[model samples]
Target chain A: MIKPTLHSGEFTYPEGTYFQAGYLTQKNAGWRTARPVLDTNACVGCLQCYLHCPDGTILETDDKKVTFDLDFCKGCGICAKVCPKNAIAMTPERGLSQ
Target chain B: MNTRELSKNEYFFGHKACAGCGGSLAVRIALKVLGDRAVAVLPAGCMSAVGFNFPQLAFANNAIISTFAGTASMMTGILAGLNARGEKDFTVVSFAGDGGTADIGIQALSGAIDRNDDILYICYDNEAYMNTGIQKSSLTPYGARTTTTPPGTVSRGNEFRKKDMLEIVRAQGIPYAATASIGYLQDYMNKVEKASKIHGTKYIHVLAPCPTGWGYATDDTVDIAKAAVDCGVWPLREFENGVYSETPARGGDKAEYLRRQTRFSHLTDEEVGAITGGSL
Candidate 1:
C-alpha cells in the first residue's frame, strides 16, 4: 500500500547537469538487480536472445535449458523491450528473488 | 522503504528561466549536484537576469553574479578568499556561457587555469552569443545559424569550425577536464561530483541548448540535447593529467539529431556530414 520513498542523501546537485550520487537505484540488499525474463515455448532457438542481449544474458544451449540470472539483468528489457516474438515480459517479484 | 523524489524546488522553482532554456537547465543541474555548500560564480549572461531580476536570487546557495569576463578570475579569488578563512568545505563554481568562456573570458580563464586555481569552471555552451541576441562567437559551429552567421543565398552560416576549447584547456594540463550535456543528466551530474572531489582546476563544458537562439520550438530542449550526445559531434570525454578517458562513445546519427533546429535546417546533407563526421 505504501511505496518506499528514496532518501535524497546529504549531497545535492549544485551544478546544472545530470549526476549520480555514486549510488545505484537498488542497493539496500546485497542482491543485484533482477533484469530479464524469457518465454520458453516461444523461444524457437532462433539465437535472437544470444545475438541481441547486450549483456550476454542468453548463452547457446543444446538442451534449451537457457539459464538466466535475474541479478545480472539491467532490466533494460533488451530481451522483452526488443523481442520480435510477443514473449519475454518482466514482472514484479515477491520471493527471496536474486 | 523511502523515495522522496529530491526537494520539490531544487532550482528553487519560479526563478524565471525561459520555457526551453538549456542554460537554465545547466544552472539547475549544477546547483543540484553541489547542494547547500556551493557558491556559484555567475557572470553577465541570461542566467544573471533569470534570477527574478531583483532580490529573489534563484540560486538557493551562496552565489555571486559578477562581470562577463571575470567568471574564472572572480571564482579563483572567491575560492582563495574562502580557503583563507579555513572554509574549505564549500565549492566555488565558475559558471559562464560560451561567449564568456570562448571569447571575452579567455584571458581570465587562462590566468586561473595557469595558476591551477581550486575552482570548478563550467562553460555552459549554447554555441554562440545567445544572451546578447545570438551573435557569433569562437565556439559557434560551422554552417550553423546565428545573427552574424545568418543564411544567405551564398552562405549557410559561420565559416569557421568551433575552436577546440577542451583541447586548449587540456594543454594547460589541469587536474581535470570534461564535456557534458543536459540531455545526459546522469552523466553530467557524475562529472560534477567527480570535479567537486578534486582540488584543482576542473573545466567542464556543458552543451546548454537555447531554443530562442537556435530557432527551435520551446518543447525540443531536452530532445535536442539528447541528440547532441547520441550524435557524435559532441564527444563526451574527460582528461586528468595526460590520461584521456572518453565518456562512452555513444553514437547517434546526424540527420535525426540536427534537423529540428532552424539553424541547422539550412545545412545540406554534405555540410552536416562534414561537420558531424570527425568534427570532434
Candidate 2:
C-alpha cells in the first residue's frame, strides 16, 4: 500500500518551509467513460503518447513499446492527438466490452 | 496546429486537475509560449493545487508559491531582484484564478501595473471560486448559479454581471491587455508570444472553463469555452497601447451554449431573450 504523504497530525515541517495541498494518490478519473486503445502493431515506440499523458497513465513495456493503465486515464485525447503513428484511439468504455 | 506542432518539450503536465480542465490546458499553452526561461509565480488557486503536487512538482521551470493576494507583488519583487542582479534573460509570469485575480489580488495587481513592472499577469477566469467549492465571485456571470447564488423561489441567480477586468487593465495605461480562450489556441498562443516580447505590465484574461463548477461534462470544456466567445457572452478582444480592437464575432448558437451548463440552467426564456437581444 502507498503510504500517505500528509496526515491529520501536527504540522511537521519547519517554519519558512513551503508545501502544497492535494491528494497523494492518483485520483480516480475512471468516470471518463472512454479510454485510449493503442495498436502495438503500428506503434513506432516514439514515446510521444507517454510524454503527453497528463494523468501519467501511460506505461512502457520491456520491449520499449508504450502501454497505459486505463483505470487512471481520463481519456483527454492528448495521447491520441500526440501520437505520431496514429496508433492510439480513444474508445468509449461501454463499447469496449462489445 | 495541435500539441504535436506546438513544441516537443512539455513544461507542465501529469498533475491532479480534473479531466478536460481548461485551466490546465491554459497553463500548458502559457508555458509553451513563455518557454524555459520563465519563472512562474502561482497564487493560492487551482494552478497552485495542480502545478505543485508536493515533492513531485509537475512544472519543469522555476516556480514559486505566493499567498492568495500576493502574487502580483511577489512577481514584481522577483522582477526587481532579477534586474538588480543583472539577470535580464528571464521572464516572470503570475498565473492566478478569477478569485485570486479579480477579487483578492486586484489591489496588488493595480499597484504592480501602476508601477509599470515588466511582468505578465495571466488570470484564468473559470468564473467562480472553483478550488474551494463553487462560490459566487465578482467575475461570475449575472445569471450563473454558484453555491452562494443558488436559485430559490424568490431569486434566480447572481444578479450582477462580470467585472470588466480588461477595462481595469486598460485603465492602468499598460502597454498590452487582451482576452483569450483555449478554443482559439493559435490566437491565444500568438498573444502570449507577443506579450513576452513587450517590456511592461501585460495582462491576458483567458476564459478557462471548470467542468465541475460549471456543471458540464469533462469532454465539453473546450466546446463550451468556444461557444461562450462565439455567442457574444465573452468577446475576444485585444488592447495595445490604449487601443481596443475586437475580433470578428462568430455568431454561434447561444441557446445551445446555455443548455449545456447547469449553472445557467435556471435562466428563464425572457432572460435568455434579454441576453440574446441585448448588446451581446
Candidate 3:
C-alpha cells in the first residue's frame, strides 16, 4: 500500500531551461541560450555525442541524424567536449543570453 | 548559465556564505542547475550547514541531510523511492565534500554507480576537510598547505598525490561523468544540464577552493580558481559515458592563476612542475 504523498511545490519547468541538475538551477533551474547546430554533413550519426549530452538538447530525428533543442541549450560546450569527429563547435549567438 | 545571468538566479542573493567559499559558490550554481524540482541530499559537511538552520535554508526546495559516508547510497534510495511513486521526474542530487566524496564516501559512491540508480552525484571538492577544520583529504593535492599537512613538519603539505576521482568514476562504466569548476561558469552549467537528462548515475567532480581554508584574499575566489585550470593543476576535461575528452584549453598565465591565492604561495617552479607533470 502507498501512503498519500504531500508534495510542497510543482515540478514544472519553462521552455528554454537548461542544466536541470546544477547549482545555477537550484532556484529557477531555467537558464538557456545558443542551441547546438548539428551539421548533418559533418555528423556520421554515431550517436556517441548524443548519449553524453547532459541537457537532452540533442535528439535523433526520424531521419536518424542527430539534432538539438536550442531553447534549452545553456551552451556549456559538452557536445563539443565529447564529439570524437570534432564535428561540434560553439557558435556565439548574437545577444543570445542564457 | 552565464555569469551575468547567474547574478539573477533565485538563490543568488541574500544568503550568507563565507568569503571566497568556492564550495558555496559551486553549490549556488550547482543547485541552480538542479532546479527547484530536485532534492538536495547533503551529508554532514560545509555544504549542509552553510546557513542551513531550521526554517532558514538557502535552497527553496526539499533538501535532506544525511550521514557523511552514505550520501550516495541514501540518494540512490531516495531516487528509487521517488521513481516508484511516479516521481521519477524529480532529480535526486547528492552534494558531498571532498572528505566525504574522495575518501570516506568513495565506497558508497562506487556502489551507487554500480547499481546505476538515476541520480546526479556531485563532489564539491575543496581538496580538504575545511568544515571540521582545514585537515587533509584524499583529494588534497601534493605540496598544498593545510593544518594537518603543515609546511613546517612535512615540507610539502599533503605528502600523497590527489586521488584521481574522474578516472575512478569512469571505471564504474556509468552513463556520464565530468570535472567542472565555478571558474568556468558556462561549462559547469552545461555539464549539470546534461547530467540531469541522463538515465543512469552521473558524477561531477567540482574543484571548489575555500578562501578561509585555502588562506587567500576572500575576494580572490574566482581568480584563484581560474588558476587551478590555467596552471593545468586541474584540467577542465569531461568524460562522457565511457569516452574521454579534454576541455578547450583556457590557456592563460599560470603565474596569475598562482599569485592570486595564498594556498599556492609555496608552489615553486619545482612543485608546479610536479603538479603539471601529473595533470598536464
Candidate 4:
C-alpha cells in the first residue's frame, strides 16, 4: 500500500516531481458484485488467470498455486472464465460469510 | 517469451480502471514486457485519466500525461532529451486511445515516423472515445452505437468505416507496425517484445474491448475480443520492412459476436452483411 505525503502550505514545493513507484493506498473490493472462490484441489497451475487478470491482483504462490489479493481485486472474474480446469467459481459477494 | 518467463514484477497496478477494463490490461501487459526502464507517455484518454490522479499516480514506471494531441510529439521530445543526456537502454513508449491516435494525434505520430524517431506508439483502440463517455471516434466501426452516433430512425450508428490505422502507419513507412488483440496474449506479447528491440518508430494498434462502452458483461472482455478476431471483424496483421502479413481468421460466426453486445443489438441482417462484406 502507498502512503501519500500530504503537502501543507508551510514547505516549499519541489521543482522536480518525486514519487515512490505507483501503488494503490485504497482497497477496491467494494466494486465487486461477485468474488472468485478458488478450488485448489482441482487446480492445475497454468497461470492463465494470472496472465489475463486486468487489475494485476492475482499472485502466484511459492508452491505453484495461485491466490488473490482481494484488497486490490475488483472481482472481475476473468480468472474464473479463463480457468481451464473449472477450478474457480464466482460466488456472489453478499453470500460470502465474513 | 512464454508466460512462465515473463517478468514477475508488476509495473502497472492499483488504478481506478473499471473491473475487466481491456485498456488497462493492454497497458499492464505492455509495461510488464517493457520493464521498469520504460518511460510511458499518455494522452488525455482513459489511461491518463485513470492512472494519473494527482497524488495517486498508478504507473510504477516514469509516466507523465501529455496533451491530447501530443503523445507522439512528447515521446519524441523525451527521446531527444534522453539522447542528449547519453541515456541508454530506455524505451520511450506512448499509450494513446483511438480518438487520440486516428483523429487528434495523427499529425504528431506522422511527424515522428517521418523522422524515424526511436519510439514506440501503442494505441489501445477501444473503438471509441470512452473516457469522456462513449462518443464516436474515427476508429469506431460502422453500425456500432456511440453517444454521438446513436442508432435511430434513418440513422444506424456510425456510418463510416473504421480508419485503417495499421495501413496508415504502414503507408508512412514505419520501421515496425502490428495489429493485436488481447485474446491472443502470446502473440501480442511477442509483438511488444519484438517492437522494443527495433530501432525506429513502432506502432501497435491493439483491439482492447471496453465492457462499459460495448454493453457486455465484464467477464466477457477477452472472449469478445477473441470473437472479433475470429469473425474477421478485427484482423491480426503486421507490417515490417515494407512487407505485410496477416494471421488467417478462424471464420467464426459473425452473428454470435454481434448479438452478444448491446451496441450491435439493433444491427439488421443486411447491415451486418454489409459490415462483413457479405461474408455471412
Candidate 5:
C-alpha cells in the first residue's frame, strides 16, 4: 500500500508544496457493501467497466482478463452493470471472505 | 476515442468520492482526455472537496483548489501566468459543479468568456449542490426535490426550469460549447478532446447525476444520466461557430425516468406531464 510520509515536530518541512501523483495513503475497501467478483471465463475484454469506473480500480491483465484492485474499489457495481457479457457480479461483501 | 484507446494511466483516482459518483467519473474521464499536461482548477465543489484532501490529492496531473466563485477567474490567471512563463502544450481546465457554475460563479465565468481567454471550463451539472447536503441550485430540473426545495402539501420541488447554460455560454460567442452525459462516454470524450484543441474559451455542460442527491440506487448513476438525455430532460447538443445542433433524443419514456428517482417520486402523473411540457 502506498503511504504518505508524516512530518514530525522535529523535522522541518519543505518550502513548497510537493507530492506524488494519485497520492492515496489509505484503503477505501471499507466503503463497499457489495464487492465485484469477476468470472474470467465469461469475460471478453470489452473494458466497458474499466472505462466507466469512477475509482479506476479495474485493471486489464496480461492475458486480456480484467481484475480489480479491491483495496480502493468502493464496489459501486458499475462494473457489473456495464458488463456486456454478465461476467461480473456484485456479491454482498458481508458473507464473502477476501 | 473508444474505451480501449483511452490512456492507461489513471490521473484521477484514490479519492474519497462516493461509490458511484457521476461527477468523479466526469472528472476522471476529462482528465484522461486532457492528460498530464492539463492543469486542473476545481472550485469548492464535490470534485474539489473529495479530491483535494489535505495530504492525499487524487489528481495525478497538476491541480489546485480555487475559490467557490473564482473557478473561471483562476483559470484565466493560470493561463496568463503560464503564458508569462512561456508555457505551451498545456490546457487550463476547470471542473466546477452546478452551483459553482450557474449560481455563485456565473459572473466570473461570464467575464472569462467576455475576454475570450484561452481555457476550457467544464461544468459537471449534478442538478443540485451535493457537497453541502443536497441543496437546490439553478441547474436543478423542475419537480426534483432537494433539501432546500422540498415538495409539500402546497409546494412542488424546484418550481423553476433548469438554466440553459449551453445557450448562455454560446450567447457570449464562445468558440466551442457542447452538452454531454456520462452515459454517452464516447460523445463526452470527443467533446472534451475537441474543446482542448480549440484556441479560445470553450465550455461543456455535462449532465452528471448524483445518486445521493437524486435519491436513486447507487449503481444507476450512468443509467439515469443516459435516461435524462433520452427523455429530453437533458438534451445532448453542441454550439459552434454561431450554430446549434442537437442529437435527436431516443424518445425514452419520461415518466419512467422520473419514476426511478425518489426525488421525483412525489410527482403525480399530471405534475409529471406538466414538467415534460404536457408531452407525457
Candidate 6:
C-alpha cells in the first residue's frame, strides 16, 4: 500500500504527485528461524556486533550497553558472527524473549 | 583512527533480506557512513525487494524507488532540485544491484558519471540478478553458474567475462571510483566514508556475495568475499583522480574461494586450475 497522494498540498511542491518515499508496507516476520541474544555481562562495549548488524536493530545505551530491538531484528546472526567476544548468541526464534 | 570505534547511526532494519545477505550488509555499512544527510535512490533490484517492501521501510533516511534504468537520472534530478533549493548539506546516493548497474541502468549511470554529478553511485554487485532468481548479469564471472548459464555437457556456467565496472566509471574521469568487498568491514567502511565525502560522481563497486545466488553457505559469505580479494581474484583497488592504488594483497587461493561455493561445484580440478591460471 502506497500513500500516492500527499492528502494536503501544504508543501512548496505539489502534494499527490510526489514519489512516496517512506512508507512501511507490512511488519515482516516468519523469515528468521533463529534470533540473536546479547549477553550484556560479557559485552566489552567493543561494538563489533552493533557495527556488523545488517539490520540497525541494535541500539547503544547511554552507558554503552547494547540491546536488540526485536520488533525489527531479522535474526540474521551477523551480530553473533561479528562479535569478537562471543557475547552475542543466536537461538531459535520462539519469541523475542530469551 | 580505530574504524571500529566510530559511532554510527543505523538507517536500515526490519527488512526481508536473507540471513547473511551481503547486499543488505553493504547497504547497512553504506548507510552508516552516509548518516541522516543522505537520500538513497534505489531501482528495481534485490535491495528493492527486501528494503523497500511497499509500506514497511527499513531505511531511517529517505529512500526512493526509481525505475530499473532511472537510478542515476532520479538522483541527478533530486540533487539538482536540492541544489536549486540551496540544500548543500545533503548527499544523493544511487544504490543498484549488478543487473541494475551493469545492464539495465548503465546508460543513465554512464551519463550521470560523465556529467560528474554530485552524487555517489554504489553498485552492490551480487554477481547475478538474485532478486529474480539466480540469473546471470553482465557482471557475472566467466565460470560461475547462474540459472541462465547452467553448466551441462555443452556449457560450463557463464561464458562471458565480467564487465570492468571500475574502468567504466573511471573512463568517465569521475572524482573517485573503487571496488570494495563486504568481507573486509574496516576497509569497506573506510572506503565508504571516503566516497561519501568526495564530490562529483564517486562510484563504489562492492562485491556483495549472495548465498542464494552464489550457492555458498550463509555463514561463509564474508569469508568467501574476503577470499576473493585475498586470492587476487577480485583485487581491492581504488582510483582517485585517475590514479590507481591497489590494496596490499593477502594470501589465499582462488581455488579455495571457488571450492567453498556450490555454484562452482561442477568445475573439474582442471577447470579450477584453468580459472586460477587465467585461461578460462
Question: Which candidate number maximizes DockQ?
Answer: 5
Query: What DockQ does candidate 5 have relative to the true complex?
Result: 0.48
lDDT of 6 by residue, B17-85 (tens): 887788988988887777678889999998988876544556768888899999999999999999999
lDDT, residue B95, model 1: 79
**Candidate 4 lDDT by residue in tens digits, B154-255:** 889988889999989999899999999999889999999999999999999999999999999999999999999999888899998888899999989887
Give candidate 6 misplaced runs (Cα > 4 Å): A1-29, A39-41, A62-65, A94-98, B1-8
Models 1 onward score TM values of 0.70, 0.82, 0.69, 0.95, 0.95, 0.89
DockQ of 6: 0.29
If both were scored by TM-score, which would come out higher, candidate 1 or candidate 2?
2
Candidates in order have lDDT scores of 0.69, 0.79, 0.69, 0.89, 0.89, 0.81
For each candidate, the DockQ is 0.02, 0.15, 0.02, 0.47, 0.48, 0.29
lDDT of 1 by residue, B1-280 (tens): 0112222224322344454567776776666667667888778877776643433344556667778888998998898788889895898887788988999998999999999988899999999987778999999987888899888898788988889899999998889999998776667878888898998899999998888888776546666777788877777888976689876657777766777778888888887777667653
Model 3 over residues B258-278: C-alpha lDDT tens digits?
A: 556576677777777656556
Docking class of 3: incorrect
Compute fnat per model.
0.00, 0.08, 0.00, 0.49, 0.53, 0.38
CAPRI rating of model 2:
incorrect
Candidate 2 C-alpha lDDT tens digits along B158-216: 88889999999898798999999977767888888889889999999999988889998
Better of 2 and 6 by DockQ: 6
| Candidate 2 residue-wise lDDT at B101 | 96
Q: Docking quality tier of candidate 4?
A: acceptable
Better of 5 and 6 by lDDT: 5
Q: List model 4 lDDT by residue over A1-98, tens digit each.
A: 22222232343334677555474455677888888888999888899999999988888888888999887789888889989999999999896864
